[model samples]
Target: MRISVIGTGYLGTTHAACMAELGFEVVGLDSDPKKIEQLASGVLPFHEPGLPELLRKHTASGRLRFTTSYAEVGAWADVHFIAVGTPQKAGDHAADMTYVDGATSALAGHITRDCLIVGKSTVPVGTARRLGNLVRESTSGDVKVDLLWNPEFLREGYAVEDTLRPDRLVAGGDSAAAIDLLKLVYAKALKSGTPFISTDLETAELVKAAANAFLATKISFINAFSEVTEHVGGDIRVLADAIGLDNRIGRRFLNAGVGFGGGCLPKDIRALQARVSELGLDRTMRFLSEVDEINLRRRDRVVHLATEILKDLQGRKIAVLGVAFKPHSDDVRDSPALDVAAQLFNAGADVSVFDPEAMENARKRFPRLNYTKSAAEALENSALTILLTEWDEFKELNPTEVGDIVESKAIIDGRNVLHVQDWLDAGWRFESLGRRSV
Candidate 1:
């Protein structure tokens, strides 16, 4: 089947390349000519593991292409997946639906043949049903344009693997044909016995929101416990392991560090709360407000710890190890690590930052902070060091080697990846979230 994916961002680019790998003719559509040009030449504009190889291979094989014109894709493809971004609105908790709406409307106007329009973007609930009506109203009567919600559940670093081998598939729409088409598109995964969930449009949209909310809640739940352990003098990691052994609470996302932050979790929870409030049932998801607060407070805690350790932040050289929200990806949106670094800088510290892949994006976000070429460069002669995102290189740093470079040997394990005893043995004062300094 011919396929077209709109908005060649993180989700769209990965989906389009994966679709091409499944042996379909795919065209990725975007309004940005520069992004389209980059993809057309098999150059990924962002950092993702294993995606660059796929893009290069597919583009070379003639099965995948990219374009700036929606009209080209609208007339050419049998299925159009809307992978546009639904970023959180500015100064509000609601999702910015401008991209999703604009893409769907453009596709509806330009599609000349019967096709399925699937929504893969994480959006507020009731968006698909509402857009489904928009599709019906906006499309020409000659073509049968239908809408479905098939929200993406891709982890940034593991996006390629997750796309090719998803845990499960969910399709929501009334049309059997639409579901069947999606099944065909995902037939490779189904052949491997991946479970398929067919539900109403609203249920499908909520699956992404609900899953993200649960994860954000899970992270905050543990961090809230971390707050207790911080005061009561207990090991939060051991506590997490004991609770995770229950099987009811899995070990995933139980790592209590600097709290959850990335493109999805923070905004998704806020969006869900905002959505419920707009529906006039504001009390339904009120707990999420606390979840958001706990997450933000973790950042504050790290900054506070730094201040206490340094005994005065002014003119102190601080080294920030990682700025990406999590390791293995360069996305800095709502990144706790980046936010902490910015916070420290604002509080009058000589902050030097380094990330394996995120320094460019981090520089764009916080240009005033000093960006360094490597961890060693950032660590050299610094009074304090903070490990924000737990990248493998940073995690594997030898305490003695790191101590030799730094003027003062004090470290904060923001992601809980460091061996506390090892740092302590190195004669460095070590601190971590939920752990009392010895």
Candidate 2:
């Protein structure tokens, strides 16, 4: 089956490459010439753990290709996946639909035969119906374009694996042909017993937002508990483990630390809230707003904890361990680590930052702050250390070694990835969110 994926960003690039890896001919289209050039040369613009190898493999075998022309994308495939971004709009909580609109309109103008235009981007509910009408109106009846909603649920670090082996597949469309085509396209997963869910377009769109909102809520819920735990001298990590053992709550996003701040969770919840307001559902949006507020307050809480550790922040040498929203990825959009580091820098602290992969992106975002090559380098002679993001390399660092380098031997476990006893045993003062200080 010939498949064309529009937009070569994280979602599109991973989807296009993985589709080819599943033994299908795939063409990835992007308007950005530089991105196209990079993909054409087998160099990925962003960092995804296993994507580069997959891109190289598929491009070398000629099963996957990159192009800048929507005309080529329209003509080359029986199915086209609209995987462009729907970023949060400026000065508002709503998502900017320009990329999705542009990609859909471009595809509509070029398609001359019956094809399924599947949306893989997270969008407001009812977007599929609206885009369906747009496609029909643009195609002038020369071609029949069936709009389908198939929202992507791939996490950043585990994107490739999630795409290839999704826990479940949810597809929504009015047409039986659209359903059958999607089944054929995802035959590998279906055969592997991956549950396939068929729903209406609105439900499918809501699924993506709801999934993200729930994940965001889970993180915030724990962080909220972390707040109370802080006052009551309780350990949140142990509480989370006990609650998670029930198998109902399941400790996925229950880690109490710096709350979620990535490209998806923070913006997606706001977008979802804005969508609810657009639909005249203010109550639903209000609840999500609280979720957002809770998530954001965690950042402030981290900052407040840092201030409490040192009586005054002026002229303190602080080291931030990780800057990416999460580990194993270089995406720093709305990153909690960067937010904390920025707050520290603004408060007259001399902050040094390091990340295994996100240092370059962090440097680009906060050039005024110092960037170090390694974790130890960032901690060198620091008055306090902050573990902002829980990268493996940061988690594996010996508290004793870190204590030996820092002048104050004080550390804040922003992500709750450290052993408090180990730091205390090493003769260092350790502070963590929602946990007893040692």
Q: What is the TM-score of each candidate against the true structure?
A: 0.99, 0.98
Candidate 2 Cα errors over 4 Å, as ranges? none
CA lDDT, every model vs. true structure: 0.94, 0.91
Decoy 2 TM-score against native: 0.98
lDDT by residue for model 1 (167-275), tens? 9888899999889988999999999999999999889988998999999999999999999999999989999999999898888889999998889999899999999
User: The CA-based lDDT of model 1 is what?
Assistant: 0.94
Give the clashing pairs for model 2.
none
Tens-digit per-residue lDDT, 1-438, candidate 2: 899999889999999999999999999999899999999999998899999999999999999999999888787799999999999999999999999999999989998777889999999998899999999889966677898999999999999999999999999889988899999999998999999999999999999998999998898899889889989999899999999988989978899988988788989999998889888988866877888888888889888988998879999999999999998889999999999999999999999999988888888888999999888889999999999888888888898777778989888889888877777888888888888777
| Predicted candidate 1, C-alpha RMSD | 0.7
